[model samples]
Target: MASPVKLYVYDLSNGIARQMSLQLTGRQIDGIWHTSVVVFGKEIFYGQGISITNPGRSHHGRPLQIIDMGETALDEQTFTEYLHEIRQHYTADKYHLLDFNCNSFTNDCVGFLTGGSIPAWIKDLPTDFLSTPFGAALRPTIDAMYRRPTPGQIPAPSPRDPQSASSLLQSVANRAAGSSSTNGYLPTPAATPLQATASVASPLQLCTNPHTLNSLFRTHRAVTVFFTSQTCPPCKMVEPVFERLAEDKASEGVAFAKVDMGVGLGGEVARAWNVRVTPTFLFFLDGNKVHELKGVDAPELRTQVDLLIYQAFPPHPHTSLNLSSIRSISLDPILFPQVPAFQTAQSKLDGFIDASSSMDAKQKAKCKQTLASPVIPFLQSRFATKINPNIPQSRVHAVCSEWNKVTATLVDALPTAELFPIVDMWRLAILDEAVANWCATGSASGSSPIHMLLDKAVSAIASSDTTAVPRNFLLTTLRMLANGFSHVTLARTLIDGRSAATPNKTASTRQNLTSVLVATLLHTDAPVRTAAASVAFNVAAHCQKPLIDAQRNGRRGVSVKIDDAEGDWEVEMVSAVVEAIGRETQSEDVVHRLTASLAFILHLSPYYEVQLKPLLDVLQARVILLAKWKGGNGGLGEQGLSKKDVRRLVEEVARNLCP
Candidate 1:
């Protein structure tokens, strides 16, 4: 066995990843990363490089998989097969490992991959179900695997769909933390008393990256993924709640992940799930299919998960105490494409659009009718138009009213931020061809018709008015621009040094635009702040900067904030902003608004995650910052130390950034 190596990962959700490169050789790298954190721990993480840097991708990737290859006659063969044939070349590897106590897990997988044709008696039960061969075969193996006890030191039965991974992980973390700090070896996971709100649904897998997604599937069980982008306003709305839930249950065997779909991670994944909107949530169970819940801030969705879990693990099972072991199979074959089908919402927009001039007059007429379905009016009746699509822009400007009306009329199934089709429309509307004709007369007096249409969308979102317009609509536009490189061919002649003109925003430009939009979104009023909170799940989409600067400057950066000094005020605005950025960023980006924004997010993150990795980085940085507030980098510690006390030291850092 390779000597067990413990690699501790700090939080680097922000721009800090820009320069990070995490590489591993056969025997030297063993690690753990805490994404939803801002605090520090004692574990040390080393890489061949200076740091881990990943420029955010256009689309988010899959979750971190935890595959356990239980004991078997050919355990090493099976394990090696999985690595060599099943999971190869998949990058962005936060984790990958082989588990020796996976007897139950392996047999279950064999059953699934072999199409569930295992013996009838062992057909449907979990491997842990006693009185069954599969279960009995692995009992000894389960005994050897490390496990934690509850207060009374009781070992958990076995791994299954965890109700609260956050809480579960917290227990392990606390114990591990305690032992590691003093002696460096955690005891074991406990059979923790199930303690949590009844409605906290277990998270499922949802990564947009194909390689990562594929790799994750090969490793983990019961996972949930939050796939979002800067263009997805609804993703933002649903983020905080998801993060809180994930944080609350991290140790419970459940993993909550946020993937940037814009990076081309999941290719055809969005389409497979019929993901017409942003902030889509997909759940998985040991590679076998689970469920998908769309939209953000959804009360109905939570109910669905609650029902599903009950079905999977009934409170009272009268059927059989010795549940049979069903083959562990994979549902991914049906869920994703090999390289990821990079279908844009535009692809789903066939026939309804007038992109062709070759259609017969009748076909054109039908297309127009299809585009302007009366259904639009029917749908809009339920959701009154806050911004009329008719103010005159492009065909889509007129068409958006129809789409918006229908979507609004129906139940909001996903976060407003992640509605890709809507984002595409917004993107199209802003094109010069779409908006050129409608502008009363500014940049497009003589411009094409599309330019005029875009103006309306731009004008509406840019307005100080934060009413019925979903935040996703605006964020989508920004995301389109931030990751706009994919459509670089769409660029018009460069007119200025700061901004480039383009027919449409593509995945490449998202990075550049993410920061600006984040700032713009933050600058709104109180109601807007509340609106942000309602859909704050967007943070799961991955668009935050630092909360404070590192320059020992007077203050932190000016991150775009959701204005919430009133109402749920801090809940969405102040707190959401802080959580969004965390404490990771470039040295420069770390200052001013970016830094301030990060500080705010950590302060607002659920208390459980307050001391998470991202926050910890800042805490560590502040330790140095305070040591030299007046002394410059701790050389003359006491002098600057007296200038500001410890608690005040941290606050001083925050005040400077926020101010």
Candidate 2:
């Protein structure tokens, strides 16, 4: 059976706490004291109010109640070490009378030991007192009496040194032996030893043995070894910076390790690596040394470490495809010119109302008003003209304002048939270079009238039920947005929003719009899938360019921060593209988009090769079969690509995986 953990409650004022509280708030309180966690008859406490001592008698009086806090998983020594780490941050010098006092320490210790917190009433007592009027008034006087001690008066406990494996094991053994003498409580049986794993959790692992160093290099895709010595001043200066870099790059499949040249096994490893300098950095890929840097240049060190990971996974060939070529492959907008069919439909509708058909007069009037409205003509004119980047900002605002009014009027009045045409017109408008440029340079506030109008129009149109609007209309709109996204400035404005940290209404709406587009790829329609793939491709291609360029230029990693959603957008887009390919493999347009998207993602970050390997393997096998069939005068498979293009794209991506 496991030993029960106990909470030792002590009254600091020796049971006169109610009188002290009455003076402060005119209310009797339970107690004004401190608390600690005691397990196996050892009294473990924190803060300046309580001293480290044996149980039964101490500066603070004996327990008012010894509440059992259930059993704990940690051994006594491990629990003590955990408390030591907490003490480094919550030292006596950093204590507060109310905010971070003795109670706070007890709460943290109890939670860590048994996975449960102390009673809420006790934990919240100080806060509750501070909330009251009289208690608040007496806070300052009370706080001054218990303020943290000045330096040299009561020295803070020193942090524990990083222990070696043997030393740590010995310490645990010593604690176990000492605990056997504790009163009444018996130590639990030793836990089964866990198998050693080469997963480094700290920002920097001090590798003192060849086995440990080898394990890290083998387990991780990329490892950076920092060779340093205790006597080297430069190494000390660069140590903190290197540790910070390790933390920043931890999620990027990079492992950081250090070896001290003055140490035993670390010295042997340093000699083997041919380290002539104290602050040498050796970057390893797949357990082999690939790059070496010597000296204490912090910026260069960060760049080289990032470069190591980048080199390990070189960009995909598709990522480097000419932007011009991608644009060429994209479908042109479905123009809605005033053709004979539209004219005939309008004439019939008018005649039907005039000849006293079943249609009501009011409905016919609405149809006539929608047809005669100058909105379509204005939209046509706007689409036809080349958007002048030199146009005054005010004039641009004026144009968008007029269009906003036109969209609102149409959305409120037009029936499904009438609205479909307007949606098509709006789709064409998004492709205009002038509109893209204007939106790119619009107000950073995200509250610009033009942006608001565009968001409202997109949400009103795209978010409507599928039965309410033509599916083709929604797909076409997505295609237009995808085409616009090819423009880097426009893509950034749409995806990242005005403020990267906090997304505004327009950004949130765009996120919703993007999610809708991604969801549409799962639809039964091939064309919808095709359009969604294009949107993903264009956005990924444009957004990933800067990150790829940064890596090429030997800069730190690039990140996208759009509201609460932060991560590698390149990876997300690649996955989405792969998913689309898996859903529908027969459409040529869809295949083209997926091919380009995969290439772009590979080009941007080759690290995703692990995640994309299965897809790549399937694609390669198909490409091989297709090439053999074409070469032997056989018919092409219905997998949506010509033999030549499929083979080339597949081969390009495969080249990046080569050693």
Candidate 3:
């Protein structure tokens, strides 16, 4: 279902990373969806997502969570945003196992967990968004565990190795092993137990217990003490506010601890500080009182209080630490920073990516070479920080948005089949990320620009020059479109509350679209057939009901499923075609289309599997249905045809069958 339709590639590479990505995107017979197969060099990185139930409850002696995502999803969206979030808490130097959605550890993640809510301000949310929190929490935990190398994963070369080949190499290896000093987790070298006291101390601080200080500093300055608490509502509000100042504005060596003064209040430490006010602000020098903010809550209170404390104790030594508690404080929330326009950058890029036929052989060769080195690598790095905390949400949006623009230029500029393999790969990658982002944020999101991406996919498929575009890319695009159409149909019904599912304004628009989708089911090209089969299945499965129902009720509402008494016409058509595909599976062309089409189904669905059943059964059902529509297989005076005529037609067709 991915752009290139990599089936045997998994068996080809042993690289751990590739193994991991493949595992995330594909599925095994046991029903696990392979999100990614991460390969670095020849060592493939892969992990199977197992769902753990009653997490602490043990069956044999192992901890577990249920691998719910393995069940199946209609499709996996681009996991770039997920990856960005993961990269921030952890690191991805080389050894990251990315799910196809770009999540490094999204084994069992799904709709609710992956994000499918509208903005918080919207009053009513779709009921489908119910499962987000459990999924979101599980994802982070999986990533944490995934980040932990296999028990005996060969140790990364030590950072302290003086003769190491490259500090850069060590950094890369350290990142692969999750040894990030900057991320929240501490970087502990192998074989070294954590020394809590020494570890918590500032780089220059000694491991001595409280009340101990260097004799050199003791003679120069006095230590200041400040008190705070975690539970105190006001205390919680001002915690970051105070930590920022303790390291910055204390103007002298400040030592502070947040006392728990709510349910468990007034501990021994409270008595020592002479607790008075709820947020009793204090200032001390040399363990002696200097001043007190009986009540200090003003704009930039840290500045006002520190100056007063300093004036009271002029003999103290130290300068402000200039700490940042928040990224940026705004006087007015309405006026925020703006994202820069990328028009100029786009123009430069556009010149390079112009249409394929216009370019010479030299240019085509350059385009192909650049696709791997620059375009592909960029996509890899761009999504590499799937879990990066450093990148802001807006910046992330900007990056994905720019990608769409760049891809548009590429599609507009280049148009050849040699580029087809990579083109479709990028196409699926972009759409996957887009869907993931859309579900996660409840906003229509994407890793690459959606419009540009569709343009490229469509262009490749429509290319008249056989050599200009890969037939595979065209077919793949068709499959993705089918699935995408179904997704949007569901989204519209659930998220937008709309009635129409397909492209046309009229319900009968199916006649035109259905023909287009079905033509590809018998595609001449192998990969083309594969791709076409997928899209045709999804589109027909979801949108064909109107045609089928129209045959019965003449545009009136028909109750097919229990709760969908008022459902649309397309559902019936999809159900009918599904029935059709199942019946025709014995034919090689039909079976290929039918089986490959399952990739776009709500994976693991009962109806999904039936989409590929042998043709005899389906042909039998079709004859019955046609008899009902035409009165009988043999024409009657009023009730119409009888079954005998239909049976005769089928026998003739079957006699001439390829088999």
Candidate 4:
């Protein structure tokens, strides 16, 4: 049977709790009460500290309500671990009467267990109470009273006790601190137990053996060792401060560690590092010992550690350049020849909408009745026919125009599920036109009506709840734009400042397009990754083509003039493309697109040498290794590109560029 999760609410005052509510809100309420969650029949509560108490034994009156929070995914062990982590963060020092309190803890537990938060009404009670004049006046007294521990409350478990919850919590905390040992401190039984509540200390791995210590130096970007003995007075004084530094710099990829020289293997490791002093510090970069310090100098230790991190991973210095080849590229919407089936769908949709809008009260009622059944199904059949490739261009154009009109009307009218099929059908039609070479760049004067309609539809779908619109539909539409629409055209439209009539609007539209494409690159879906990579490839290829041509024609000094308004469009484009490539290097489905993108960057290397070095640096080793691999010679797999083809391309690019 599934474990039951219940929220036990209690009254926090003497007399009837309803009296206090009546005075505060002019209505009878259950009373101002503390809350706890009872999971598996054990009442767990968070206060000044986490504690367990007998059910209904506390001064806080009987629970006013027990909210059933449904079944939990957590088993006993996982639930214990969950509570341990909570204890680390929701410690006595961190608790606040108004903000971080029992209600907050309950909300967190419920969210973790069931993926659903506690009711807003219950969670917001404190805030609501505090907002009132009576609440504000009594805040000081209430806070002081809340901080006191109730009699007979069970103390938080001890970390020294092997079977206790604190030990479990400490083991978890030590891992975050970078310590790998189950017995984190020195194996000496006399060693003082580290407090469980001291989670703010930097992740310091307690090194018991040389192999573990050696691994830390190799795995981390940088490692700092705090060599100290239990007997050293100064070392003991500065230990907490050093821990604080470790915690602060943990995310910066620096591993902080401590070796207790008073005991066992730590003493041996300290001697190996030539530690003559009781407290010594060693800093390593890329597995090489780079710096050392002695004594309890906290400030110097912090400074040297900061310097080590900076040296390990220096910031990228972006270079600016203006390439005439990229400037000459066209920015226009790719317009495809209309399809007959699309026109039919559009015509039918227009008539239905017109009929619905123009109908009298009774007629409208009849139209509404038919909207889902006949009207929608008929539109779906008509739209699906647009995917037929045998249709003539002229007929296709007429159909596409009609379909575009119908889609615009259906954007707000149809449910997301119904609208997704139509949008996907439209995408397939665009993809078909792209394959046929019928889609070509149009005038840069204004946005394409079809593009605008599709964009509107996408915006509406994206803004809706995830349950309403399927993720695949969104990915497919994005993929369609990436494959069918030329990035060169889009980039040119964005950078072209000559059209002064509506620059702001033009820029906004271009930015929206760029934002969507960039965001799509980070999606977890493999198909979405492949499609987004294709879009990045197009953008990179277009930007690089001009530079390649300029170099080929021997016009080394020829530069394209860009207005300050265009700013770093070239840089941003390259960054986005490079980022996409970096993210998808290991993705099997996107190998072709990744290689194509890299090839463009390699081709443009001479023109944007300084700016493109980082891209080269990242891909150099992987490309060389992949190029040398003699993989199976298969024709295109499901992703439509052979591994052999990708390998050859990477080799060709590397051979020409790296040399």
- C-alpha TM-score for every candidate: 0.22, 0.40, 0.29, 0.34
1-659 per-residue lDDT for model 4 (tens digits): 46888888764443344433432322234544467778865776665456555554433436777888889867877777656534544555444445455665676667556656566666667646654334544454444432334211223443532232223223322221221212111112233334311332234665643644775665566888888776799997777777777767765657787777753356668778888786888999888889999888888988998898777744312112233323233333223223235445445544544555434556434434444444344334444455533545455455444444445456545443444445545455544432112222221223333354335534654586423445655565565565454332233332231222235544444454555566666666776666667666655555455455545454332223334433344445545654564455346546556556655554444434454555446645344434333332221223322465555555554444443
lDDT of each: 0.32, 0.53, 0.33, 0.51
Which parts of model 2 have CA positions greater than 4 angstroms off?
Answer: 1-393, 412-418, 437-469, 498-510, 550-572, 583-585, 606-640, 654-659
- Pairing residues by index, what is the TM-score of model 3? 0.29
Worst lDDT 10-window in candidate 3: 326-335
Summarize candidate 3's per-residue lDDT along 1-659 as a digit string, tens digits: 32211100111112332222212211111111122211111111122112112222222122112222222222233332322222322222212221211122222122212222112111111111111222222333323433344411323333532222223223322332331112122222233221211111211111011222222123223333334443456754654465565444322434433333321222434565576555666544545556665343634457544554445333201112121211011111011111112233333333544544666667555554554444444444444436523434354445444444444445555554333443344444433333334322321122223333344444444554433445644554554444344233222222212112223323222333343444444445655554555555545334333223332232211112223322322333344444544334223344433422322221212232223223324445344333332443321223532344333333222232101
RMSD of each: 26.8, 19.5, 27.7, 21.8
Best by TM-score: 2
Tell me model 1's lDDT, rounded to 2 decimals. 0.32
Q: Could you tell me how far off, in angstroms, the CA of residue 119 lies in candidate 4 after the best superposition?
A: 67
Indicate the worst ten consecutive residues by lDDT in candidate 4: 179-188
Model 1 C-alpha lDDT per residue in residues 192-217, reported as the tens digit of each score? 21212111132333343343354445
Model 2 scores a TM of: 0.40
Candidate 3 overall Cα lDDT vs. reference?
0.33
